[model samples]
Target: MVTDTRLYRKVTAQAWDRLDSRPARRTAWLGYDGSLPVIAGTVICLVVQKLPGGGGNKPVEAS
Candidate 1:
């Protein structure tokens, strides 16, 4: 739970926008374990890219 109002508001707004624009990408689940609600899931990488470098791969030396 977020205690800071400003942070909470910012996160809420971002969530609302994502929910509106990408509803299909959202995931939700509800379960009970001994009268207690439990939630577990995994989040995969959303974006992956290569880093900029020279042609040949080489290790840098420290002086």
Candidate 2:
């Protein structure tokens, strides 16, 4: 799908604003340092866990 550059930028800016305005306080005690990697890893894990054969077997990669 194609996205318009101007609209994308506007939406991104608004999202950032809302994200920054969120009420939750960031903490370092939970192994999270308010980084994107933590969020990405959480989403990936959730998706993998929901997929069939996710825990049973993994696809072998070719070297």
Candidate 3:
């Protein structure tokens, strides 16, 4: 899970150019930017509410 910032920047620049050429994916990404947070929060709240022992105590697995 290591990143090289310089390579990432270079690839991202190229990807943006390529993505900008397409109307569909670009428009999808436009909505994703706004909706991701609300979606993620809802999922997290649902999981926590469903967790056993009333959600305060986190379970740690033995390594």
lDDT of 3 by residue, 1-63 (tens): 222343222111111121122233445466554333311111111112233333453544421
For residue 34, what is the lDDT in candidate 1?
A: 37
Candidate 2 C-alpha lDDT tens digits along 1-63: 222343222111111121222324455346655543322111111112233333543544321
lDDT of 1 at 17: 21
Misplaced by over 4 Å in model 1 are 1-36, 48-63
How much does candidate 3 score in TM-score? 0.15
What TM-score fits each model? Answer: 0.18, 0.14, 0.15
What lDDT does candidate 2 reach at residue 25?
A: 47
lDDT of 1 by residue, 25-46 (tens): 2233234223333333333222
Candidate 3 segments whose C-alpha is farther than 4 A from its true place: 1-49, 57-59
TM-score of 2: 0.14
- What value of lDDT does candidate 2 attain over all alpha carbons? 0.29
